[model samples]
Target: MNSRLQHLLEQWSNDQFTEADKQELIEMLRSASAEREIIPVLQDMWEKTEDEGLFSEEHQQTIIKNILDRYPAGELPDKKEIVPTMYAIHRTHFIRRWRWAVASSVALIIGIGAYYWYQHMQGKRPVDMVQSTTRVQPGQNGALLTLSNGSQVLLDTLQNGRIVLQGGVVARIRNGILLYEGTGSEVQYNTISTPKGRQFQLQLSDGTNVWLNAESSIRYPVTFAGNERLVRIIGEVFLEVAQNPSIPFRVDVNGSTWLEVLGTSFNVNAYENEGAIRTTLQEGSLRVVGDRFNGHLQKVLSPGQQALTTKGNADIRVFDDVNAASVTAWKDGVFDFNNVPLEEAMRQLARWYDIEVVYQQPVPKVQLGGTIKRSLPFADVLYFLGKVGLHYKLEGNRRLIVLP
Candidate 1:
């Protein structure tokens, strides 16, 4: 065993390891031979400590299966080679001393090792050998605000203060939140649009809270003046409509779909590339209407129900028992991939990273299942995807070419 690896292991066993030491230990264990040696040590440590019931046997098996199933048939490493790595990756994290943090670090090591091992089996250059000159950071809180007078303000760069719009309507930005104050009778409209790699939060004049996802926009009146409060949105938005039984709130999505909210919380995904508009109701009831090219369709959704409207189709499909948390995970700073298709996952990445994805070959038929933090760097995100047998190459700073 390497002296440094031994010292790190001692620190970890004694619960004295710093984060950097833990990371270094993970990197060192990337060697297959080292993995074999570390497995026994991890098992011994686990055996000495009483099981804390952190992860059940069924859950552990499921996680192991999820990782192993990423490889194609007959291409997987030998069972002897894989079992030890899996044990090391899965069991070490369960040590009562460093449960969650150690799990993340160990899982990353396994992902990196699997990616390199697959590349070796295919006679391709390892990931480290690839030339990547650019580092893309995660998206930030920012958007472009279009005033009623056709003037635009870059919210990311603007100072936090009160801004008087047309007719003396005041908008304030404090701690990165846009809040509208006072009331107006003229019903002037303002639009907040988030470009790729950006998101923003806004409190409408009616006290409704709106969260704009990447490449999304919401246009609404400066204040609620009439009996009906109406807004138009593009891309995706999660809204918590303020309760007002007298006035109904309506959302016009890209001029194709309409959502009526009677004080409900829901999310709308209407990206053109997605081929369908998905509205997942989180709380309260929502009425969704789809205006297709041929006909019109509508559906009333209950809480936890999702309505899907295909573009150019006249039918509105409602799915029951939908995962509302997974649907609005982005708003909560997570990328939920539970049963998400590969193309859809890539689209999320493209939007958040502000990069274009091009397929050099046929798109891989894969379903990803996991949750990753949206705060991770672009490179780390790609590394996590490698656990699913996905390969890619970054060209220049903005293009991600998917490999077969």
Candidate 2:
């Protein structure tokens, strides 16, 4: 037996293994030669817990099978050739110190049974098995559409058909997308707002597409009439403007910032709770102008660039080589937390899950990485967080209290 492996086994048996120890154990498990020694240690540990009824015989076998399935006989690839697969069972980055969570969720295979066993011994229930009836579903496609006449329509429940608006303008709903048809000289404004736990998609009369994230609202004219197409947005929005050099597109974010679109696709995050309004350009060019008390501060953003401006501040900061894909991941139904801080990640969960996050203590200085599907159940998402040492409690049905 290797001395280092022996030390790791001892740490595991004593419930004193640090994150580095667990990572080293995972690496050893990847190799075939080490498996010969590691498997017996796990079996021995399981046998010791058998009398205590920690896990059923069937459950123990399933855990062993899951671990073995990762490295089949004579099929384990070389260590240097292992490439991380996206959204794999083993590929999930959990809490701040759990760096291996960034590799995959399957990395928990070695610790899961032990985790349950320890919880049993400690007379505590697992997070998933907690006696709570509260269930918070994930966000879905939905929005509140306010017409020019102050009449509101719920887009999620409305059937697919043509919606007649003022000035003879027609807005059609097809497969959860709001599409506009026909032109009207009478300019009437319409607003689409998505509440918490909902998102929406829209297409302007000029063929420009718009995606509204949760807790967002966009107000635009029913038809494009002026030399420049303009819209006002609050919260986050992604726009794919139709190319029309003759009539440029413009966006007014929170009545404080403006985005001059030069026929391109970009995303604007102007949530009031956020520290700064971020404008990330996916492709083409955009000029971000800030309304300062003295004058206007502006910056031109190229592809993969992000411009951040604070409310009531004149200076605009540009971040070059930004991850535009990660910035726009929400538009594609993903929560990309690539180097995002803990509170910010919680804010996203608050919006998507329609839950308020109450911290029981001072916020932990933790940075999170990796991506999670927006469609996962709230509890499942919490389970991943628990694996990384995040202790949380669901209060009632909509409040998530983070414990220190």
Could you list the CA RMSD of all candidates, in the order they appear?
6.7, 13.6
Kindly report which residue stretches of model 1 are placed more than 4 angstroms away from their true locations once superposed.
1-133, 292-296
TM-score of 2: 0.70
In candidate 2 the C-alpha lDDT for residue 355 amounts to: 87
In candidate 2 the C-alpha lDDT for residue 329 amounts to 93
Measured with C-alpha atoms, the lDDT of residue 88 in candidate 2 is 23
Local distance difference test scores for all models: 0.76, 0.73
Candidate 2 ranges beyond 4 A from true positions:
1-134, 292-296
| lDDT of candidate model 1 versus the reference | 0.76
For residues 62-160, could you state the per-residue lDDT of candidate 2 as single tens digits?
Answer: 433444333211122222322222122221222233322221222234343344344453365545444441367889999999998899998878658
